[model samples]
Target: MAHSRGKRRLRTLVRNGWISDQHGAWPMVILPAFVGAQLAHRGSIAATADTLAVIDPVLATSLPITWLTGFLCFTAIERWALTPKKRRPSCLPAIITWGTIATTTGLITVIRSPMLLLWTPVFLPLFVAALWEVLHRRPRSPLARLTTVTAASLMLPVFALGVVGAPSPLRTTPELWRATAILGSYFVGTVPFVRSMIRARSDHRWEHASVLWHLTSAVLILLATIWGAVSWPIGVLWVIIACRAWAFPRWQRAHGPVKPIIIGMLEIVLSIVLSALIILA
Candidate 1:
């Protein structure tokens, strides 16, 4: 009976989208957290340690909350949005996740970071809208793209504030703002290339669209490098990304990364490397 009960519990977790898949979703939180922390530390190990001394618990508590937020939000959208029949809510997962969000947000409040709490309201609606797009099977919809990109973009500022340990105004640090733009662009830019990859596959027009978008990005990075707006390393990194976008379709047509998950992993690696290079630069 105990064994059977454990199986039942596992089934519940899977049904709620907590334990079923591995599509690199967690990186959505991780990349921003890493970049934010790294930027906050400014590549100084001592600074990172000092900040971590106070924020360690908060980070530990928040990681799962962030993941659960994405999981439950997406699950709710998948079941409710675009369906004629309303599916029953995953009550256990919903309760646990909402409770965690509340607890973590409250902890941030105790730390006196109001801006962090502010993210809750802004992100909730965006997540809903993004998930709605996903559920409606409209990956290329403007509304979908806008909401998802906006949500992903916000990660930079939110993470910066989290690492800084204070509720300073946006302008207090120019680097964080620049980091926000660079990281946000990286997040939002994925939408077109990825949508093209899945929705258009080997279609020449879509392939060309992806290639053009990436090349344009590379050119912008080159300009930024020339202007000394960013380090030369970033320009090189952007070129690498542009090359991937340029060559990926042809590779896919022949070799088959075949699975969306595989493509997602590639993107994750690039994002991590880009974030690392930004920090090093």
Candidate 2:
């Protein structure tokens, strides 16, 4: 009976260590990469008739998959690292397994496209800040959240570079940075909007901050459209989300706390819509 109970306990620890509880982060991880790749593919096709002929089929397919796998493993390790030190010993197996996978996949990706190394300077600071936050057990702090979100959104340009075969000097077009700004702005706004709903639900200050951020995002989007960085259609999409950021908190307060699952599902839909609009634009 003792041995059986010990086995069950070990299994529970392993399960907990391996599975991430950050349900909302999945879209943040995926959408930018997909949008980046799609936009790059479009740009390449427009640039030349023989775009597909030049793309390495294996590298084109494998890079994103490998990068994503490494990222997921790194996320798992981060989660495990956040657990109480006393309990961390129980989670070491899972942590070691994920760490090894992350390192291996990351090495393979960098080796395949050494030009990706150019991004190291941009990403290293963000990684350090994020690591500091995690180590300090403040992973959910606003600064930490923003750091992670910015890094994820910047993957837009990185994935774009990857798709176009990592040119020398790592040149990124205005379109890539424009998409990054749009996506990054939306994600940064979500940090406050989500907090207003759940963590700081009673804090009127967070509500105000959320509304103000959304309005700012709307104005920026409008300006981008006027400057021809984005189309009117993309600007229109921003208006919709800005209105959502304005309305949802009021609705939640009038009724009651919406289930987290509902909030997560709605965010997924919004992310999908945002990605589609950017790609189409």
Candidate 3:
């Protein structure tokens, strides 16, 4: 019985060490990268039909995979590092394993594409802010959450750089920034929308603020469409997101608390739709 209990406890620790409980964060990390890859594929086709045809399949596949692995490892290490001091000793194995993987993969990626280092200036401050939040135990603060969302959104350009087979500075193209803005706006708006539902559910002000933010996002996207900055499809998607933001809280207020899984599923569907529209448009 003692041996069986010990085995179970070890299994639980290992599982908790490897898997993240922050389910909402996965989409933020993944969707931007997916959008970037699709956009790059599209850009390559537009630039030259033979562009992708000539590129090495291994290279095209490996860069993003390696980068993503390194990124996930880093995040896992960060999560472990943030554990309470008394619990941190138990997290040591996870931290060391993830840290090693993160370092090795990160080095390989940077060596393969040295130009990626150019993003240092962009990411450094955000990293600092994120670290500050972690140290201060304010990871859920609006500023901290926005900082994280912004960092994730910027990965779109990073993935684009890998797929488009170019090393140009991220600022060279307006389209990259524009797409980042569209994606970032949705994620930033999510911070408040989620807070209104869970953490600040009793605060009417959060609901109002969330509605206002979504409406503003929808209007801004509409204006961008009118200005020919983005296509109408993206504008329509923003409007749909805005409606979701407005309607869901009222439903929750009347019906009582909704299951988090249902909320997560709805966001997943919306994220898929958003990614598809962005790519198609």
TM-score of each: 0.73, 0.86, 0.84
For residues 1-281, could you state the per-residue lDDT of candidate 3 as single tens digits?
A: 99999888766664446655577888888899888777776663223343343333443666666655555554555566567777766656665776676576566667666777888899889878976876676767787888888888888877776554555553335676678788888888888888888888899888898899999889988999999988998888889899989999899999999888888888878887887777777
Candidate 1 minimal-lDDT segment of 10 residues: 43-52
Candidate 2 Cα outliers beyond 4 Å, as residue runs: 1-15, 44-53, 168-170
The local distance difference test score of each candidate is 0.64, 0.76, 0.75
Give the per-residue lDDT digits (tens) of candidate 1, residues 51-138.
3334444653554355446555554444333334443455446545655665665565446555566567788898777767766776
For model 1, name the residue pairs that clash: none
Candidate 2 lDDT over residue span 94-212, tens digit each: 66776676677567667776777888888899888987887777879887898889888988877777665655323545677778888888888889988988899899888899899
Choose the strongest candidate by TM-score: 2
By TM-score, the candidates rank as: 2, 3, 1
**Model 3 TM-score, all chains together:** 0.84
Task: Give lDDT for model 2.
Answer: 0.76
Instruction: Return the clash pairs for model 2, or none.
Output: none
Off by over 4 Å in 3: 1-16, 44-62, 170-173
> Per-residue error at 27 for model 1, in Å?
1.9
lDDT of 3 at 189: 86
